[model samples]
Target chain A: MSAVEKASRPRVAIVNFGMGNLFSVRQACLRAGLEPSITSKKAELLEADGVILPGVGAFGRAMETLREQGLVSVLKDLAAAGRPFMGICLGLQLLFDESIEFGRHEGMAIFAGQVVRLEPGIGPAGRPLKIPEIGWKPLRPPSGRGWDGSLLEGLPEGAHMYFVHSFHALAAKSESVLAITPFGDMNYCAAVQQGRLFACQFHPERSGPVGLKVYENFRKMILSGR
Target chain B: MAAVRFIARLDVKGPNLVKGVHLEGLRVLGKPEDFARHYYENGIDELIFMDVVASLYGRNSLLDIIRKTSSEIFIPLSVGGGLRSIEDIRAVLAAGADKVCLNTAAIANPELVREASRCFGSSTIVVSIEAIRQPDGSYEAYTDNGRQKTGVEAVGWARRAAELGAGEIMITSVDREGTGQGYDLALTKSVASAVDIPVIACGGAGRKEHVGDAVTQGWANAVGVASLLHYNVLDVVGGTGSYEEEGNIEYLKGRRGFSHVERSSLGEIKEYLRGLGLECR
Candidate 1:
């Protein structure tokens, strides 16, 4: 709670639009040596040196809550301002232009993409692939790309991170795709980076040490003012 | 296949972390938070804290423990035992549990699984089925920590739960639990094959090979281990914090170990799994 008052450290606002637990996100920030404030106020989010949009819930419900809180435009403006902005899990889905979950829903349109469910299919090993790919999966860089200047800089290739979700983002602009994770017979866009905005479909806060490095990278980005 | 998840499951009785054989006669080990932190520091993929006495006592007391753990350890945390309603599930998720495992409530009211999954996404809801083998070679679902039988077939219940909207299924064998005889491979394979959702095999993992066997042979997507990891770290992570309750101080005081359960660290288990070419985080 006192983390927000520390003016000497870089401030990171964890956007709370009534999704789910923000404590783990805040804790991860503190461990990363960044001051995190869990707030919904527009002024607090706009004033932070960096912002993290973390969520866990349905895509429709989360977008509805953000619209109700009048935070849809606030998020768009934060992305426009080019601050170190990030999203996790459902937060990553909300960055897309629209989501086909439950029903057709509009996202913040930060990126040109659509959120879609992981269709049930067959695994390469001749087993039925499960929906809601809920476990640890290694992240692979897109073709001809690697984690050099992105938030995943220090992480080794194929570093496993915890993921728990049923839907994933399909960016229309393939160049924005930072990482892809293999599940069953297909690979999904697991992380993306565009300008100052970085988002991932995995919960780094719940992913232990390999995950903590992600926060550390975010902190470094904030400190460098990049 | 994705990397197999290795979860450290700690059963809690009152304020102290407890372990039992066949889910009964729970002996207090230490504070749940202590064990949770230790596991987190040691690279556990996930953590499950089940309030073992919550259903019998009609109350859940894992919120504070979860709040404390979530503030430090960064890993997926699943909580079970005594979650009977949407509000109960919501309260725990709000308190920092990423997923809520429903057993007694899901069986008594199958609609609860649908309602909860609808309210809080299917991935957030996990249906925990505690199974005990019967005379006819069928696994029967038991409630209240294996103290009450629901007369429902375990494999059938797992399929029904998934159909009703459970994103994951955790099948724990009451017979193999705490006995260190290895997991009930038959029970685990039956439920895993019955549902397309991820299945976590729990109970009776006494060796690293057992952990490997659960995935390679039993077809489990994950494994929930207790004594194999808990008894191995008590000496390093010491805590009897704020537990004035009776029967909570004897086990740690004596430093006695389990003969049935083998001592192994989380790192060792993962290493052993990797040696088998089984991908584990």
Candidate 2:
């Protein structure tokens, strides 16, 4: 295949640490018109045009799996390379330096932030809205460049996406923050994009068609050498 | 004022979408990805994709459908049908399903519910009950896609499911299914009263009033319906005609204008919930 053809059919690797929604990531990549491969293999990470880190469940367990698989160094190297890389949910949280869920656990430190619990003060319907805010919630993009310029292209601002998490990201640096969603008494960053790395607190795959467009945007970026 | 909640269900057979009466019969619709996108754009609180043939296939093909659907639509998607073991639950959750609904499996092996809850957390497990009314005026639980009678009472099964760590109980009335006669309020209230967790009333729902009835009279936290929103299926002509002769053409055109309600951001949903006096913990 020609270089352009090969590049168009980029192989997107979904890093599997046995704690993430990997199959969804793989399926999203395929729908976005790319070849998706799931691997804990370090070699696959190096060979792939783009990488995705997806997670669900606990931070401590995820860290344990990542460390056990020796993917910590591999992920760092890939991010340092500036290839198109994205993280979802705990995957996005892991891109940060650490999380305070169930105790302090160190993350990949790809981004400068800390994951903290959803503020306990705000209650919905006279009852605690509960942890892991389940179901669909809307996202508001930042002004100026907006979502279209980065990983969120083709998805409309204020579009509702699926979310299922108890903790939210508090970016250390405001410049790295790309989007914010208001929950309870706090407004926190929902998406962060620093250079080629992008992370979403919501599951784009679960977000419906608006989410699929996100994958398509990622595919376009990887193909166009962005 | 009470906040309205809507849930969209996508029935799947292999990689394709399908719908049927009860659970034995089915007709293919289209690719799940397409339907999921349509529903997300149209304003749905949550989506459910049931692998109608998962039990027979001995595996959840809904995983692949979820993977495909999730990539396109950013919405909470629940997968059901053919969940027999913890391994099956793990595979489905790992495949991008937000929650796994257990019906036949939960009835057969109640421990599986506890095991799944312990491993994946109770919030990720949902227990689905297919209930049919017997001659004695008691609703008996049926399993194996509603093909076999369990002789277990619906209310009792619902209680057991919750006790075993099922985060939510989905009660479906098989007799009232696809009939659009409104949900079986008694069935819903009985199950809801029997469980501490949220109860979702499924089966028949034909109008907006029915939605309110499910939430109020039925005492259900949520309601699940399929036929009323099938974009590809025709409406019952005066409630008559074979489903096949009705044809797979888009009906209800120009009769009702679609909602112009903008998609609320996560923050907005929180605000709305707050406005409703809900505590967002």
Candidate 3:
């Protein structure tokens, strides 16, 4: 595509799971100057220049909906095809192997991991500090990543992002971790990037300007086909 | 300065972070760690995680998210959703949450507020009231994500929440939610007037000026919005649409809402206050 055509906006799809933050995701995409479409249709998802899977509810329900929609295989196929696929919150967790929230439920299994609770024994003792950790915390990106990727570009390392969730990914391999945040005695991975798939455990849309940069960077990658 | 208190809200279901209106707008933002770090870096004063689906799920996942976030953020965190008894409150607090918010559970068992305050102190207890404007022009309290009407008056609930030892009352208007129309000033003022403790006005914010309005006109301590800020609709981009445009971008900018203007004014006031060798507070 020529520069003029390259400047043409890409059609982005923000996957709707019937239980996620579609507005915020859609709004963020629009602010990034990308025309965003919300859909659960597999064909629409596969047709997009890039796909964003955003969720904010239960793990099992999200999985069930994805399975019902038959999106599980398409998303995995898209990722395997090196198409840029991003997952936010539950969307990210759903990329894991499974979750132990209420019971064992299979995930997309795109990444090698399981979603597990942040056990109380690992943190400060007053009470078992509430589950679903909310608010902002600092993010430490992986060393020497050079901040040039589709995500975390134009954003400084150690920048904080908004988060609200009860469980986190227990990655089967440590290399999948793109960033880490210190919580109590444990340091948990914040962003995980494996191949063309990018997943974050925080709400970039809600993280203000610094967070907006992440979305913009993602848009740039989608446009550049990088 | 009172540190301009900030409260972070985490709406969750099962193990995922969910956002929506009356359980819509469903999309996950990010992982618990990403959100926690972002808010901490942005200088949030306090954080709140409400499991919008907790009651239906019969479990509070805010505790798990809180424990993970608190370990990373090192800021005050509050957890809510499906919180029914003192044990639930205790479990959340122990998980690293500094406060616990009560909605349906507190309404069902008003004594839970008192019990929570006794064990965790009033400062750590918050009462969240979801209100929707009725066709009669009065606001009715709703429970279960506005699914059930309680016929409880908004003002009455504010007073009751305070009396029941709630340190703060968070009032969210369903009608104005995600609309960016500006907060319901009249309703906010009534609730603020009814309670001595801090009152947070949530919903219908599209700009920084809305924050000031919520604080000044609504007499609220804070304002909450998920759409405008989350979407970057704010005029962070300083530009008037080009000469090709019919009018100046400045006019188009302010048309979104007045809260942005109010916030800018507040910033100026704070700066002026500093220059005058006086505290903004």
Q: Which candidate has the highest TM-score of all?
A: 1
Q: In order, what fnat does every candidate score?
A: 0.78, 0.34, 0.00
For model 3 chain A, the run of ten residues with the poorest summed lDDT: A122-131
TM-score-based ranking:
1, 2, 3
Better of 2 and 3 by TM-score: 2
lDDT of 3 by residue, B157-197 (tens): 88998887787788988777656678888888888777756
> Model 2, which residues run further than 4 Å from truth?
A119-130, A142-145, A223-226, B1-6, B10-55, B58-77, B87-98, B118-124, B131-168, B173-176, B184-199, B212-222, B235-281
Segments of candidate 3 deviating more than 4 angstroms: A1-7, A121-128, A143-146, B1-281
Model 2 residue B61 distance off true place after TM-score fit, in angstroms: 8.5
Q: Estimate the lDDT of model 1.
A: 0.87
- Distance from true location, Cα of B119 in model 3, Å: 30
TM-score (C-alpha) between model 3 and the true structure: 0.52
The residue-by-residue lDDT of candidate 1 on A1-226, one tens digit each, is 4645454478899998877678788888988888889999999988899999999888888999889889999889888888899999999999999999888999989899899988877763445667778888899999999888899998988889989888899999999999999876578899999878999999888778878999998887887774
Tens digit of per-residue lDDT, candidate 2, span B1-281: 11234567777676556656675556545556766666667666678988776732334356656666665665567888887888887777766777889998788889999988778866688899999999999999997667799889989988888888777888889887766678899999888667656677898765545655676577666668676666332221211222333223232223232121222233343354455443221
Query: Model 3, residue A14: displacement in angstroms?
Result: 1.0
Clashes of each: 0, 31, 73
Model 3 chain B lDDT-worst window of ten = B238-247
Q: Which ten residues in a row have the lowest lDDT in candidate 1 chain B?
A: B53-62
